[model samples]
Target chain A: MCEANVYLIDKEGNEKLLLESVDKLVPSDESIMLENIFSQRKTVKARIKEMALVEHRIVLEEKD
Target chain B: MCEANVYLIDKEGNEKLLLESVDKLVPSDESIMLENIFSQRKTVKARIKEMALVEHRIVLEEKD
Candidate 1:
């Protein structure tokens, strides 16, 4: 599966896993929506911080 | 292939195709790196504007 693992990164450079095996990501307004292959969905108020597509890792920065 | 098509979105909300069938994306210092399944590589000074993973569309905002 090309689905990616999502993480939340804080200003201090700490990373926290947000979701696993996420198959889809949609941006809406100021938030991002994540959907897994199983159709499980989640929404986070954050912005794209960094991405390593080949590594299936996506980092996000939470909005204040 | 699971690679995504990359686009550059301007402040006016206009979209411009940057790359096609990109298989990997990596963030560096002040740029984002793109690599295709064929190992083609490119670097752009931009930030993620939005992403539609299921649609294989990745939007980016060019840095000024």
Candidate 2:
């Protein structure tokens, strides 16, 4: 239940799914490293726009 | 285990504890509404700096 699906909001205010089951977010150099339950990993250059943990949804900043 | 302790980063890069055992984060108008296990609620105007869910730590943006 701690895991969340990460979404990237576009300039048009649309949500684009980015990652799933994200269990960890580590801040890297100008980016955030996301690690999921299946051990999948990716780095994203965005801040959190919103965190709806209870809903298992995490909205990230708009794309650059 | 899904609950997290929220912290706000100060201008000096110091962490100031804001909320504990927070389980929900709802995006409001220019603010985020946080709700804890104890039913305590608060609204904060900031973006996410980091989310170390495995460590139960949620670091928010610095003060405006």
Candidate 3:
């Protein structure tokens, strides 16, 4: 019904929790903006690596 | 309320419609499984590149 939690994966393949209950995602000029159910917003320099919506998990790899 | 349309981005960065109204995405062994609202299922060897849920768009790049 809602969006999944976004996690940032490091080069060593470690998963770092970024945001929770993300409701929407918007791609911007050089980054992506995330908005949660509470309207909490975060902009990240990362790209989606994988998404398992059924499992409520989203993996992203940070970029420069 | 629902999921977004899944698009495949080729090497040339062209967007090609893959699935519409995708409701769920499940990560499998080496591929990802997608399910639509009508229970339609499709498995693709791809990786998530970007998502603009508010815009109802999900971009994926094919993988070997």
Candidate 4:
């Protein structure tokens, strides 16, 4: 199975974001394809938007 | 910040398990306290030991 923990850091550098125990990883393209599927779930979509790779951490740092 | 896309399958039919785009999500006690902060790296510890969670799709099916 796939379990992922999603987190985010806003422009304020505050780490108030923390998604405990995810179960899948949707690709960018697939994410887009599934946008409609996930549109209603803004939280999930937002989490997907804040997705990036950072030293094997898969970080989602807010860009200015 | 974190993203995660991990998949696995071994012990029956095939379905092209894919780990397209992962960002982060490693719990289980901080992945067992980082597992020595790094130990020869064994396939991300067998993909976190096939974490189980249906529906969402964190699957690593391989059992006898």
Local error of candidate 3 at residue B3 (angstroms): 5.3
Docking class of 1: acceptable
Residue B24 shift from truth in candidate 3, angstroms: 6.2
Identify the superior model by TM-score, candidate 1 or candidate 2. Answer: 2
Report interface Cα RMSD per prediction.
3.3, 3.3, 4.7, 10.5
lDDT digits (tens) for residues A1-64 of candidate 4: 2333456666676764344444334433112111122232213322223222323223334443
lDDT for each candidate structure: 0.79, 0.78, 0.75, 0.34
What does the lDDT read for residue A2 in candidate 2? Answer: 77
Candidate DockQ values, in order, are 0.36, 0.41, 0.25, 0.12
lDDT value for candidate 4?
A: 0.34
After TM-score superposition, the amount by which residue A13's alpha carbon in candidate 1 deviates from its true location, in angstroms, is 4.4
Model 1 lDDT, residue B56, Cα: 78
Write out fnat for all predictions, comma-separated: 0.32, 0.47, 0.25, 0.20
RMSD of 2: 3.5
- The number of the candidate with the highest TM-score is 2
TM-score, first chain, each model: 0.87, 0.83, 0.86, 0.39
lDDT of 1 by residue, A1-64 (tens): 5778899977777889989988777755588888887888889997766666667778888876
- Minimal lDDT window, size 10, model 2 chain A: A46-55
Look at candidate 3 and tell me the lDDT of residue B63: 75
Kindly report the interface RMSD of candidate 2, rounded to 1 decimal. 3.3
What TM-score does each of the candidates earn? 0.65, 0.67, 0.57, 0.30
